[model samples]
Target: MFGGSRRVRQAALFDGASLPRKHISLGGWCGPALMLGKLGLRTEAYPFDFSRVTLDGLMHFIQNGFAEGFYPPGPPPYRPECVGPWVLFRGQHTAFAHFDLNDPRVQAHFQVKMHRFDAVLDAPERPVTFFRTVTARHPQEELALALDLEEAVARRNRSLDFRIVFMVHDQGLRASAVQLAPLSPRVSLWALRYRGLPSDTLFDRTHTAYHAVMLHSVAEENWSAVKVGVVPPPPATMASAEGWDFERNVLVCDGAARTEDVPFADLTITRFPWRSHDNLALIDGVASVGGTCTGIGSTKMLANASAALHVQRLARLKCRYCGDATYHAAGRPFRTDRPFTDEEDQLVLIHLYKILTGGDKVAAVEKLAHEMRRGTYEVICRIQYLTNSSTKLMDSFDPNSLSDP
Candidate 1:
């Protein structure tokens, strides 16, 4: 949400690159690749590009194509671990899938159809004029129902009003699609990982993908609270303190030596996820095909959320420095005419507590000050310093800074 600058373009491209971090900054290969030749990034280019994409559904097609090919009905040709570095952008819907097994002899059933998953992902409320979800259940039937689609097609032929989406799951690529489309481009699959099983020797096929999504299931923990038009506040702990030496980073960013721009090769490494406390293992001992750490089985994956944590920290630090510089260079207009009232002082501390803690639930700083053995007066003094320095710093830059404060 920035004006006509690099920041604006960065925000626009987050969908193509990864999830929304606290903020987006120009770095690695992205900065020069997108910006320089065009005399750096522009805000106008982004919105224009977005509107065009939405109007034509170009990006949707690209992502849809990626997901479709990511998992094949049959075995994969190459080692899944050798594959990858697939970019993950946030989806409009949480994305889901559902399939049911029922007796084939029972003719009564409802069929779900989706012409394109991208359309649903783009607009969940877009009227179901065409593609919608359908899963037929045949209790007496087996998964092998996939093999007998000819009978299923005949049964559908007998019905006067047969919506194409409802059909036997075992139908071959063309048989299932013949009624609705040559091929139903829509696929409700997300969060795919490699399955341990290899391809059958008789027929070479794609590796079976164990996907987190199905036909019509939303990921609850990540997407249930669909509060329309709500903007999430920035993350308090910019980056987990585990990686960068916070204190040192600040000293360096505010005063580090020999700073050269880092490249994006390992910018590849930056987006990996961490081990959640879950106990598990890989599908077939093939954790990840790509060089990056997005493992398949028991291997822990790095969430895109963490990628920008540190980046924001660093950017925010530099941003504060730049803001202060810009302010001074412009002659300290940020020097508010009047001092903060007592109530305002408390409010400022309260805001700080809210921001620097566990997502507004707990005031980590208030407790941290105590744990650090700072007496009541020191805490007050620290708060005053923080308030004075940071008031102008709000909306100044991205988060995660260089080193320790």
Candidate 2:
């Protein structure tokens, strides 16, 4: 079916250019010569005028035709993908296809049907209506439509009805209504890459192809979390003057105090709550007790609580790289080029532990002063410096950039 006489007049307002048929398919030089003669564009070396042919405009034409019911079904000459459903309509700018949104078979499979109502209403005065329905073979399974078609009809101001019905073997058939929405005019064409399999032959090749699908959206936001291990210093021993020794316990942490439990080499627990502020408190310390640092056993015990909190915090953020975000946020700061020192490493562990345990701000600062062998004011200043400088650090080391397997 075609649009009404008045609607046809309105459609005439949009007179797009005719695309060259030769460009539609792959052919040798002879085909192009024949096509040029047919279209009257050939004049020995004279370039053809392509003012009307545009990817966007062509896509709009096809989408509009599909919405307006200008296309009829037949034994198509080429495969769906090769010639492309919209390619033939390139010459008939006013031609379109009527997508059966109410098709029961399609509804049964997809559950939802997205129609390009926008394309149908290109000529606002000519509106389209779509119907949908479903059926089940079992009496217990009753078919239904979720969308309100009447409301859609009134909204689109269309006279045509696109009815869809489903057939059930025993229960018979049922019908429903579907609301049609406008189709976007923008179209993007991309070259797809396909890899042939070993069993593939020229006549029957099986290939894996990858293509990107784009959608229009109003807004979007992305965030991520990193995990860092915090290992406390071991108690003072005769063998080493350092208060703690991670090598004996088999666990060593990177600068920010996120904890992790590896094999014997490291028994660190990967704790969560991946914020830089959270890790700073533990790395520095809280009050008189300074922070607790036992062997691997105690460290693991402490990490349990910290890790839980970290996970909960990450869940709250709803970040993409949840674990990595916590790790990076709690890790120790170091210039990419410089090597870390034992004292610096020990401090990192202490800071991570304190932060993980929900160490009090005032108490943690006081403990850091005692452990680092620095004054309370000095420790407080260091915490402040780290807090302020970390903003810049996170910008560069964004945990969101990391991919998850």
Candidate 3:
């Protein structure tokens, strides 16, 4: 999506004040023709096109060629010097890379940078009134003291050494403060370690020796995992139709309706157990899955039934054959002008029978519907009703019945 070819044309202008007499040379023609050839264009057409090209047109073409090469590949790699406030140093091999700026080992390390900010009190602004009240009780030695009473333990012994231990008890409390003030609590401290001093000394007699001091802080910004590539799910198939078998507790469409064998990157399956008696389906247990079956065009009863039962639920419940519409439960139909036909009634009856019998005839009907391209219920109902009517008509004229009358 990022890289593609482009073409541009530019015009040349000469000012009388700058150049008293100037003839614009066709220098632009040479650059474009050479570039086009390098980009896989044929050199033979160069002369024919070049002669007709204007200086402006030639300049535009060159600019277009440069634009095509501007967008390269993925983003440039991270440079440590260019890194900002916080650097996300992920474990490369097993060893943790040093954050020392001078360390070459850290130079090649892959890290993500982030920014942070903090505030300090303006100590110089305090007036003599506030300073006197705060400093009046403290001696000059106490005021200049760098170590607290606990830190003075170093003065009693020389062999004793102190260690700074840092533990990240929790990673959740690292939020930036809204404002800075003298009374504002220090959220966390920088632990310091040193050797003991002499009993009479004001400072530690032993020089401080430094070791690794873990700096624990949280990013001031949100971070998200960078997605590389994703493999999608396989396309739907007949096996997926097992999901639609509610009696088996597999209430999904098993994808038996797909005609093509091509695989898809992703597929979604849903269950519709309550769709069996859905009013939208002229024949129950069948409802269009995606959209209405109207545009499917002059299909047989089997196609319509399959679409309703297997493919999707109807967007609207208009008869596929006659366009006689039905309401969605309590909703009004577009028009109630047309009455239900005998064919529709028969289809409905057969579907009702199947429901009543706990789908006893479903397997046989499904097979027939698929094979004949005529819906099983509709065809069977028409035949049964016609035969019964004929039998009744014949019985009315029976010799025994006539004698009794």
Please, what are the lDDT tens digits per residue for candidate 3 over residues 1-405?
Answer: 000113332222211223211111111112222222332222123211121121222222223321211111112221111011111111100001112222333233211110000000112111110000000011221112212311332332223322211111111111110011111111111111212322211112111111111111111110122111222221133244322232442223213322122222211111101111111111122211111122111111223333344321122233343443321111111112334467655654565465345442323333333333343333333434645634221112221222121
Please give me the total number of clashing residue pairs in predicted model 3.
26
Per-residue lDDT of 212 in model 2: 11
Q: Order the candidates by lDDT, highest first — what do you get?
A: 2, 3, 1
1 or 3: which has the higher TM-score?
1
Q: Report lDDT (CA) for all predictions.
A: 0.21, 0.22, 0.21
**Candidate 2 per-residue C-alpha lDDT over 1-405 given as tens digits, one digit per residue, 9 for 90 to 100:** 110011111222112424221111001012222222233323222111111111122233333322321121122221110011111111111111111212334223222212223333333332221211111112112111112323333344344322211111111001010111111111111111112332232111101110011101100110011112223222222133211233554322222222432222221212211112211111122100011111001001112233455541121121121212221222221112324356754674477466546543333443454345443333433444555634211111222221111
Candidates, ranked, TM-score: 1, 2, 3
lDDT of 1 by residue, 304-341 (tens): 33334442111111111112111011111111233446
TM-score of 1: 0.16
Global fold similarity of model 3 (TM-score):
0.14
Q: In model 1, how large is the Cα lDDT of residue 391?
A: 29
Evaluated at residue 111, the lDDT of candidate 1 is: 15
Off by over 4 Å in 3: 1-359, 385-405
TM-score-best of 2 and 3: 2
Off by over 4 Å in 1: 1-118, 121-235, 238-243, 250-282, 286-405
Give the lDDT of residue 347 in candidate 2: 75
State which candidate has the highest TM-score: 1
